[model samples]
Target: MANLDIKIREAELADLELILAFISEKSEFDGVPHLLEATADKLKQTLLFVESPLVRVLLAEVGDTAVGFAMFYASYSSLLAQPCLWLDDLFLQSHFRGMGVGTALLKSLARIAESTNCGRMEWTVNTGNVPGIAFYQKQGARILENIRLCRIDGDAINLLAGQ
Candidate 1:
């Protein structure tokens, strides 16, 4: 891994174009068109959501290029009675891996959480993603065992629309 001169900074509207491009490019590798689910208009709404703290995006810049990014939202757990940062998406281009870009991005999130007095930082990585799981372990993040995630997206609701 080369010495990555990475700068971690909060993203701005000007970053939307690059973010969209990176998201579009990465979907090809993951075989997911998830970005298609987030049009520009939706992103605008996310940044302005009043019910929740606005989703924040952080860009990892290497020299003059943005090689990675992360998007996250904040939430509070009534049971825990504390706030948490829910990481939604994290991506680093293949060429930038093994150079600490991911770690830097994660650290930035931790800083945000600490500065905001958050209680936890959490995210879910696919089980089939062995490398990602290992990386989280390396970062001292333990998996929450015995917990399953249930999701209801547009498709599910669309199917039950007539019911």
Candidate 2:
């Protein structure tokens, strides 16, 4: 599928709804639909209305059909003493899989990181998602065995704010 008609472009404010739909689809495909809390309004506020936006979205299309998207943000790497790019989400439609859509999205991100002088690009995959893990590995990404992801959200986040 190297000759696939995949074109990756930076998302714009007009793509809010499309991006939200893609996110929902990704959550459902990953068997976590109940965890999807994104909506067009919220996406507009955070992804478009903010003064200093925290995220950048890249959309992949094939002849006007939206196939996938990658959402990322900038971060700092203390050890490297340089900027890093954190890929929060990368997803493609089921039919688009194995057609190099994912690879194109990742490669575009790598180029963006390089252009911006980012030291590293990072993202996490679900442990049970074997295919996803394998894809990353095949792309020369190392799966760190010792590091674990932690987060606070929902009521816990509110409680922490109150304290």
Q: What's the TM-score of every candidate structure? A: 0.87, 0.94
Q: What is the lDDT of residue 54 in candidate 2?
A: 74
lDDT of 1 by residue, 11-63 (tens): 88778778877777667656677546666666766663335547888999999
lDDT of 2 at 128: 93
Writing each residue's lDDT as its tens digit, candidate 2 over 87-113 gives 999999888887899999999999999
lDDT of every predicted structure (CA atoms):
0.83, 0.91
Error of 2 at 16 (Å): 1.1
Model 1 lDDT at residue 61 = 97
lDDT of 2 at 99: 82
Candidate 1's TM-score reads: 0.87
Best candidate (score: lDDT): 2
